[model samples]
Each structure stands twice: as structure tokens, then as C-alpha cells.
Target: MKDMFCFQCEQTAKGTGCEVKGVCGKTAPTAGLQDKLVGATIGLARAVQKTKATEATDVCIKKALFTTVTNVNFDNESLTKMIACVEKKKAELDPSAENYDMAKLWEDNEDIRSLKTLILLGIKGVAAYAHHAEVLGFRDPVVDAFFYKALVAIGSADAGMNDLLPLVLETGTVNLACMGLLDKANTETYGTPVPTEVPLTIEKGPFIIITGHDLRDLHLLLEQTKGKGINIYTHGEMLPAHAYPGLKKYPQLKGNFGTAWQNQQKEFADVPAPILYTTNCIMPVKDSYADRVFTTDVVQYPSMVHIGDEKDFTPVIEKALALGGYKEDKEMTGINGGKKLLTGFGHGTVLGVADKVIEAVKAGDIKHFFLVAGCDGAKPGRNYYTEFVEKTPKDTIVLTLACGKFRFNDLDLGTIGGLPRLMDMGQCNDAYSAIQVAVALADAFKCGVNELPLSMVLSWYEQKAVCILLTLLSLGIKNILLGPSLPAFISPNVLNVLVENYNIGPISTPEADMAKLLS
Candidate 1:
């Protein structure tokens, strides 16, 4: 009957959290449902540990975990079915191991609840990454095992920081592995990305606008739309597709459509094409343009036509044909009035130039590298990212990924040592690319990743971002600046542990934070 949330960031204030319930606007029943869903996912992870990994088992774990990510799946019916599937998996794995009551974790003491919440929510984030990697034909034993271990700890009263702290970092460490696996899957499947310019223009003629974070779905849509006289445009995280040989080779796969995820509500209104969402950061639908919205894979919306396994995509195509896009070629500009945006500075691209990067750093030509990356949200203060990137000295290189880069990605940051000052490293999943680049740079310098002159200033609005942050922490990369606001779910105790162990902090003004970071 009530909502409950622990506001954990600057975006939320007296009105952000449900005073009596939650600042996140989460209802008690929905909160209860989420708890049950997470518990079942833990059970599923435990089941997979007992049994050999199979397509079904992996799908169950991935979909279950990803479904619970913030703003992904909001339907109770879908969640309940997933929970049932997990329970069935548990029964098949160990008939005697009792299913742990998950509600207990939510009902634990405040301090214990806080710490456990960090581990559990953090793992949920990790699970999303692991799931993405698993889909791409990559899997790691270390990453898989931690899911079971962490899930088991959630229900254990005997667990402590001695146990949870390791688990927290383990989530990060495994996430790194998972990210590596995904990097392999992506680069291997789609040839390594190269620096390519992408337009924000919605070109004239029949076209479909694909959004969210799934490359697989985008690939499928590209296949279906080809030879149909229709064009495909990337939106949000999909911008990096311009770098991949697999997707970019499709000639019909046109340029980008909108800026970032948060701008879709305003950007997509009255659009002359159908939009497909394959992942998160989807906003509540507005009536003016709801007819053009379609979702596939893990992304779902009530009353929307969900493209199932059949993946026919007939409806989306039909909508595209009907809309017929622009009357003539429509040229658009990015947030900064730039006619084009660039992407595909993935790990391969970054590492291929490792010699140049190292040399630049050594010669003091490039003094610092900033990973100004993460999810973009509607938070008013998020413009700090754009400002941060704008103010970064010309001598510094900025690496960015996911939808956040749309904030400043359009700016022609010029070049340093034959490379652009700003490099677009694909989607959030491609944070794997960023990690790979960092490791290679470290190796070139003959040092650890932390020893490299790189600072990660991340902005998170959802769970996938959470897992990536944990992976960074797990790798022992210190002094991360996270913004535009912290999750409402992380408690003070958990935050304290993160601050003490990893030195993570919130973002300040671009000038102030950049000065602090560069100094």
C-alpha cells in the first residue's frame, strides 16, 4: 500500500523518494515483486552452479536478472512467469536444497540489509553484463560461480563484510571477465570497430529507427530490412554500430537518429518512422507517438507489440513503409550543431594505437585520459558530463561509451597525436572495449591498470551501469567520480564501504572535478 526507497544521490531530495515509502517511486507490491524476482534469480544462479550450463539455463539467468534492471521490465505477469521458471530450475538442480525465502533479506536489520543490498543489487548489475556476454557465445567460470556464491550469501545470516566485501569486488572482477568475453564476442563477430563519422540526420525515404543496447536485434533488423528499400538508423547506444564491419557493411544501415536515451521522449515525437527497443533506458510512452514504438528481447512495455522469438519484424517494417520517413532527405545536427557524430573507437581501435597513446603520454603531449562514460538520464545536472568533456584540455583524450556520450559526443574535440581527443567506444557493454584499451595501455607502459593516467567519471541511471562500476572497483581502479546522481537503492553503509575500499565519489562541476582529476 506504500512505497519504500532509500534515496542515495543528489537528484533525489524531499520529493525524489517516497517519503513514507521510496524516493524511487517504487510501490510496496512492486518492491516485493522485485525482491522475489531477485531471490529467484539467485536460486537460478545456484541451480546453474549445480548443473551444467545450457542454453535454457543461461537464458533463464540472463533474462531473469536483466528483467529486474531499473526501467526494463515493469510487468508483474512477466516477472511472475520468470520467477516460476527459476523455481523450476532450482528444483531440477537440487531437489533437497530448500528455496530460500527472499523476503527475509528485504526485512533484515537496516545495516545488514544495507550491506546485503549492495552485494545483491551489485550482482544484479553483474548478471546483466554476464547475460550480455553469454548471449554473444562467451562464458566464464569465474563469472558464473560468483553468481551462485553471491546469491547464496544473500540468504545467509552468517555472512559479513569479510564475506560481502569480497563478493562486492568479486562482482566487479567477474564483470571484468564477463566484459572481456563480450568484447571478444562483439569484435570477433563484428570486425573490430574503426573511427567512423555517423550522422544524426533522419535521412529521407522509408526507414526504421532502432534504439536501446542490443546488437543482435539490430543485426536481425538490418537483415530483415535489407533489399526492402528501407534504411536503418542507429539511436542511443546503437551509434557505435557505424564502427562495426558486420552492421555497417549493410549499406541500408544508415546513420544515427536521435541523441541519447533521455532525449527520446522529445526526439521521437511526431517522428516519421517506427522505433525498435532491444534493451533499457526506455521512458514511459507518450500517447502522441506510442504507435511507432516496438520492443524485442528483454525490453517490454504494457500494450506494446513485443517482437517474440519469431522476430518476424513484419509490423515494424509495415510501420516504416507507412510512415515513408522524410519527404526529402532530412539533415539533422547533434547537440553541438555538428552535422555528424563519430563512433567505433573500440578496444581494437584504441589498442591498435597503443604505441601512439603511450608515446603521447610519455612525451607529456597527452597528460591524462578520462573515461567520461555511462548511461544518460533526464537529470538536469547531467550536463556536467558535456561540460567536463568540453573543458578537458586539448592535450587529454576522452573515451566514452553507452548513451551518455550523446551529451557531448557531437563536439569536434579536435585531435591529439593523430587521434581524436574524444573516442566513442561503442555501447555500455563495450565498456569491455574501454577496459581492454586500458589494460593494453598499462601493459605498454609496463604497469598495472591503475598506474595508467586514466580517470573514470561515470554517470549511472540503471543497473547495467551498476555492474560495470563494480567491475571497475573489482579491478582496483580507484578514484571514480559517479554522477549525475547515485542510485536511491545504495545505503549509507554500503556507500561508506565503497568510499573506504574503492574511493568512489559523486561528480561535481566539470571545471572543479576536471581540475581535481587533472591535478
Candidate 2:
């Protein structure tokens, strides 16, 4: 038997192929099955676009896409079942079209291979946002149709860069819509986020540490833990929950725990509380904390307690009680000396005061807007983000999110125009919030998002960040500064295409990049 078979997306095999099996935990059979699922989904997307779209079709597309995300699914049985579901949906939507063979795309020419990779990867990213929106009961036609269009492009060899390039961007544009849908769903469900300070310390007694990007799960946990004498701490992307009015109102919803996803092994090793992972970025668990880790939603780990359909968190609660936390009230601080950090500056809060922001800009009080956000990693170069935010000119406002905020989330940048210079807009998924704020600002200034005197300097460590970047590109937002390291997966040709069309580049030193962006 072959040792491996990879080539799922751009991050697969250096734009050529993957070595030592799948880097994302996929084996030869599993990888082959995923490609089959992707081909079937493309066929389904193509079939559905020809007619009216329905909720069922959208849900099917989303689930299939999510199943293929790195580290999400590894079961061949589940993947094969998903592929069958795609076939059923394709048949239900368009009973007459010939089934498109996915093998054609994989076997196409290398140049065509590069272009289709962009579209496929872009849509994979789009599927993530769509999945999030679907969870919140939101869906859009344009976004749904493009999933088919992108897949159809992958199936057709006639298409080239000229065709796939625009399609890749369309993924970003649709992501904007998908994000808007999610933003609406979240803010509407939980109430608008506002400026609130959350502590980093765990308290005495029982508590739950919730990570991942899903607020619905976090909300449910907060509801279940109510009056149970258990405290809840936000970990990873959930750190921004402190800003939500509904969540913050819970007295036991307590503070934050741990740092970024990469550090979870060391951070949670000795913790006295159970940790819940609602989505991706779950590292391989250590035996020390293995018993205390739990997974809900799409996050799965072997032997860990998984809170399923009942959504009942009693097991997690009991684990917290057994751990019983510290014997006394504990104190904690962020990377800086600050004991508290501020968040909840989502689009609603920012846009509600759009006129004031415009006035501030016109009055020359807020000189620039800097979006220094993305996923944080274990690498050393990441400290540059903390330094970058720290050195931002006093007149500039820095908006941040995802796990990267852990680097400097504790740093107090003071305030500008009665607003903190450093604003945390929730998790990586909340890139939707940052985009909304930018779009609102652009609307107020009567200019495009690019012309709004704002800069996006980001760090990415996983697929979620990849999708967000595609969404940014889809929106035609340019001059993004990306760093820590380039994806070991993106081929040179694909990188060239992004650089030429979108002005995307690796981040240099904060000083040099800042001067260039400001200039």
C-alpha cells in the first residue's frame, strides 16, 4: 500500500504535492476520499447554480466544505457519506446535467493546476464563513451561486488565470456577504458588543475555560452554568466575548484563560478547570490536561468528553467542580503589566458612531486606522505584532483580533478621541467585524475601503485565517501586510498571482512597513 496520497488544497504539497502523508492528519485513503467529496461538491454547486437555491442545498454545501477543512475530519466513512450526500443534492437540484469528473481537475496541466488551486482554496475558505453563517440561520444566494461557479471552474480545463483570478476574488466578495450575515446573526442574537474590560486571571472555585470561534456554544455554556456557582473564562478567539452585552451580564462568566491556540498544551497543562474547544486550532492534547479537555461542534479529539446534541454541559460542569479551581481568588495579568484588556468594538459599536469617527478624521484627530490582526503562532517573529501596536503613533487606532491579540492584548495603548487606541474586535471569525467597521468608515468618507487610510497587517497560522484573507481579497481590499511566515503550502506561481493582483506582501519590520503604509 502507498504510504501517502495528498494534494487537497494550496497548503497541500508545496503547490506540487504533500510528503509523509497529509500534514493535516489525513492519510492516503482519507485524502483520496476528500478529493472525491470536493469533486462531488463542485458538481453539486454547478447543478444548483443552474436553478433556484434552497436552504437544504446551502446546508449540504457548507457541511461538505467544512468536512474537508484541515484537522476537522479524518474518518473515511464520514467523508464518503458526505460525498454521497453531495451526489443526492446534485441529483435533486439538476437531474439532467452530466456529472463532472473531479479527476479531470487534479490531472490537468500545471499552469491550470495553479489557477484552479486558488479558486478551490478560495472557495474552501468561503465555505468556512458560509458554514458559520448557516449555523446562525443566515444564507445568501450570491454566495451560494459562487460556490458552484468556483467548483465548475475547477472542473473545466478551458479556464485559466484570467478566468480563475476574478473567480478567486469573487470568493472574497462573497465572503464579505457571508461575514455580513454572520455579523448580523451574532450581534442580533447577543446584542451589540461594547467597550468592556475582561480580566486574564482565573478565580477561586469551579470554572470552565471555553475556546474556539463559536459564540452560540459559549452562550449555551454561559446559560447552563448560570447560578451553578461555576465561573467561565474566555480562551483563544472567545476572549472577545467580554464585549458582548448579554454574555458580560452573566456574573459567573468571569474572565479569560490561556493565550493563543499554539500555547494551549503548556498553558492548560496544570489548569484546574475543564477546557471546551468549539472549533479549529485545537492542538494535540497533552496527557496532563487530556482528561480536562472537551470538544463540541466540529472539534473532535479522542477520549475527550464531547458535549453533543443535547448541548448539555453537565460533564464539563462536573469536571470543573471536581477540579474545584484555586482555593482563593486568583490574580492574573496580560503580557503587559495591565491586569485588564478591552474588547467589544465590533461594527455595530464602531458604525453607530460613524459620524463621530468621520468628524474625528476630518478634524485630524484620528490620523490613521491600523488593523493589526490574525492568528498567533509559536514562532519568534510574532513578537513584532506587540512591538508594532506598542509603537503605533498616538493618533492612530489599532484594531486587532484572533489569537494574535494574545501577544499584546494586555498592552494598554491609552485612548484616542475617547476610544482606546487598541481595540479587540473578537476572534479570527470576527474579522467580519473589522471589515464592517472599515466598510462603514469608507461609506462615511465616501471612499472605498482601500482609500480610507486604514492598513491591515496580519499574522496567520491556520485555515481559518486563510479564509479571512480570501474574504479580504474578495472585497478588493489591498495592501495587506502578512507575516510570521508564508504558508509552506503556497506555490511560487500562486504567490505571484496574489502579489500582482492584490498587492499582498509579507510583513517587514513594523517601522519600515508603517512608514510605507502611512506614506
Candidate 3:
């Protein structure tokens, strides 16, 4: 019998399912526990459909799904406890509802399996965004309701391609709403992001590096660490925290530490400070630095100190002071050898200058706009993103988000019509910002978004990228160039549907693709 079956991420073994161990370093047992957790979540959703869903049920559902996302939780004990919690909640809702068998979906027909996997994984991404917004005291009923609907659909024995295909698109549609909700929650709570330069240098003295997508955790850590003489540095998806007025106000929130999520093992090997993870993209804990690792929210690793629901950061703070950081100031550079990174060109900042952008485009100062964004991975061929940005025409603008920008974010692309040619939007969820800007620009040009001189070259690694791509497709956007590889779960028949309907194709060489896009 297979020890584990998983193909949810782009880097699945041999471009197929992982039958023994996960490429992300998850063991067979850990993968099995995650499957059980997902099964239990499906049961909870089934129960909620029969009875009514309370806020507690909603919170449990989101947390349960988020827990199964890639690299979020690796502790078998935590997974077992989460399964129990989900089962307990399911019983409270309706004792008759039973957990769905994941094997049924996994062993189903190829097209049906492909459609179901898209809906299931896509909502995992939505659940992450919903959890982020929920922690900030924001909730959308539509986004919440769809979680139950999607889980129910996945578990339905009668569900076919026709039924699952629309849900696949609906997953994207709801994710768009969820992303917008998160944008509102973030902007309203932390204030709209402003364009600011973030350094790649690490200062001397005690410090803590916080990674992942949770801003409230960062805000609370910034609050607890105030006047403590310890510095805080953003890592991975948390790098954009330096641009928020609410976060940047903390004088001790130092510059970023490393590049993207995939580089953490090498980048963090010798750091003298504790690293706190607040969300996904955590690799296996290495013995070299396991003692200094801390996690909170949905991120967990065995034996790592986790700041629980109380939001207490004392352990992390104490660990920082214990390490004492570098003896002298440490300078760092990005992948391109640039010493600084610029972020905070979110939708708010971009739309603030819409008139200027519109005028520039009308005068032919801006030829085309390329949104080269999405998650980065450890796989080869990712250099395509770097070379693509470097080869773009001077009159074209490049907008990037998520860790993928690390490939070329530090390059000095200069400017076009008083604006930097390459603009950094926020994190993965900030795909909402990219979509909003596209629609606004389309409105101003009196053309459809696809008709505008824009091309989307996206690189996806995990479920979050799945939902974002679905969102783009549901919006009727076409000709998006996706790479370094297509998803393993997508059946050839389904891929043909996407190519016929949306014209989506895997990326070729940067030179050839750029020429094709321009042509």
C-alpha cells in the first residue's frame, strides 16, 4: 500500500503524486495525519450543512483547512489534536454526519479527481486568507458560507465534472472576495501601505526574525518588544511589514533578513537570533537551528516554542535577548546583489497615481505592463522570472508580488515617466491589488482587462497560488503565461479546457515568451 498520496504542490515527486514521502520534507505519518485532518474537516462541513453553522464552527473550519496547507504544520501531535477538535465540533453540529473517505476522491476518475482537487486545494488557499482577515476582526458571510459549500461538494459522491467545474470557478470567485476582504481588513486596521525602501542589512545587538503572513502577530510583537532594546526583522512573506505605517512606526523593526521562503534553511543556518513563523512555507526543522525556532498561529514544528492564542510573545522576546545577534553590523544583498529592496506599491499606492499612469500610457511613455508575480520555489528554471524582467523593454512596467519578486526585486530597473519601472505589490493575497489596478486601468482605457497591453507571467508553488489563478480565470482574463511547471493535479482534459477557454499555457523561454507577448 502507498504510505502517502499527495500532489497538491507544484513540486510533487516525478511530476506525479508523492506515494512515499513529500518533496516538502513531510514524512509518511505526518502526511497521513494531515489527510485525517482534512477528512475530519469534511465531516464538520457536512454536519454544518445539516444543522446551522455558528461562529465557532466557522472558525474551526477555517483553522482546520489552514492547518493542512503545505508547510503550515508538521507536528503530528498538533495534527492529531486538530482532528479531534474537528470531530468534536462535528458531533456538536450533528452526530449522524460521518467523516468522508479521502481515498474515494483520490481513486476516482482522472477528470473528476482533477476537478475535485482544484476545489479542495483552492479553498485551502482561501482559508488562509480568511483566517488572516478573521484575526483582524473582519468577516464576510459569503466567504464563510462557501467553505461549507465547497467541502460538501468535495465529499459528494454524485459530484461530476459539470458540478465540480463550476465549483472550481466559484472557488476562484469566492477567493477574489476573500482577498478583497483581507485587503480591506489590512488597510483599515494598519492603514494603506505606502511606498518605502527596506534595507537588506542586519544591525548589531539582540533581534528576532518573524516570517509568514500574519500582521497582527507582527503588530503585537512590535508592541511587546517596545523599548526592550531588541530589534525585529521581517523574513519571507513578512518582508512587506516594513512598509505599513502601523508597523514601520516601531523604531526597532529592523530591515529584512533573507530572500524568499525556499532559502530559509541556508540563510538561517548561522543566524544568532530566534526565528518566529506566523504562517505557511516552513521547511523541516533542522537540528542546527531547531532550538532557536518559534512558531505561532497555524505554523507549527515539533519541539519549537509556539506562542498560543493569548498572543503572548515573551518566549520569542526572551529568545531574542538570549542570542545577542551579531557582534557587529551585518550587511546583506538580494539575489541580484542589490543592497536594498523597495515594497508598498499596493493597490492603494498605485491607484493614488492612476492619473499619472494613465497620462503616461496615453503619451506612449509606458508601452506594456507585466505582472510577473506569485510564489517562488527551490526548483530549477525559476531563473526564467529573473531573465524575463531583465529583458523587458524600457518603456514597459513590471509589477511583482509575493516571494517570486526576490528573483529580481533588487535589480535597479530605473524608472519610466517618474515611476519606478518595477513596482512591488504586497504579498500573495495582494493579488487583489493587482486585479483592482487592472480593472481601474481597463476602465480608464475603455477596454477589457485582457484587451489592455498587459501580460501575466505567474509562478506558483502552493495552494495560495492555486486560488489566485482561479480568481484570474474567473475574471475572464486570458493568455496568462504560467510556469516553471503546470500543476500535477490538472488532467490533460482539464488543461485542454483551460487552454481553449482562457488561453493559459506553460511559459517558454523568457526571450521567446516576451517576443510572443509583445507580438
Alpha-carbon shift of residue 187 in model 2 (angstroms): 1.3
Q: Identify the runs in model 3 with alpha carbons over 4 angstroms from their true place.
A: none
Q: Encode model 1's per-residue lDDT on 1-519: one tens digit a residue.
A: 334443332344452444353223344565556668777766666566666656666667667777776667655666677778888877887665556666576567766776676677676677776766666677786676666777778877798767776777777777777777777777788888888988766667999989877777888888888899899998887788788888889999879887887688899999889989887656777887899999887777767778987788999999999999898888888888888988888877778878888888889999999999988877688889988888999889999998888888889889987899988888888888888788888887889987788999999876678778887887788899988876666668778877998789988888889889877
- TM per candidate: 0.92, 0.88, 0.99
lDDT string for model 3 (420-442, tens) is: 99999989999999999999999
Worst 10 residues of 1 by lDDT: 1-10
Model 1 residue 192 lDDT?
A: 82
- Candidate 2 lDDT for residue 276: 89
Tens digits of lDDT, candidate 2, 1-519: 444545543344554467467655567787777778887887786787687667787788777877676666655766777788879878987877455665566556666775676567667767777777777677787788777777777877578767876776676677777777777777888888898878777778998899877888888998998888999998878888888887888899888886777778888888898998887657667888988988876666556676776789999999999989988877877766678878888777878877778888999999999999987776568889988888899999999888898899888788877878888888777898888788788887789998988999998765567768888887778889998766644567888877898899998898998889889
> Lowest-lDDT window of 10 residues in candidate 2?
7-16
Locate the minimum summed-lDDT window of 10 residues in model 3: 281-290
Please give the clash total of every predicted structure, in order. 12, 4, 0
* 29: Cα error in model 2, Å: 5.2
In terms of TM-score, the best-performing candidate is: 3
- Better candidate by TM-score, 1 or 2: 1
Candidates 1 and 3 compared: the better one by TM-score is: 3
Q: Sort the candidates on TM-score, descending order.
A: 3, 1, 2
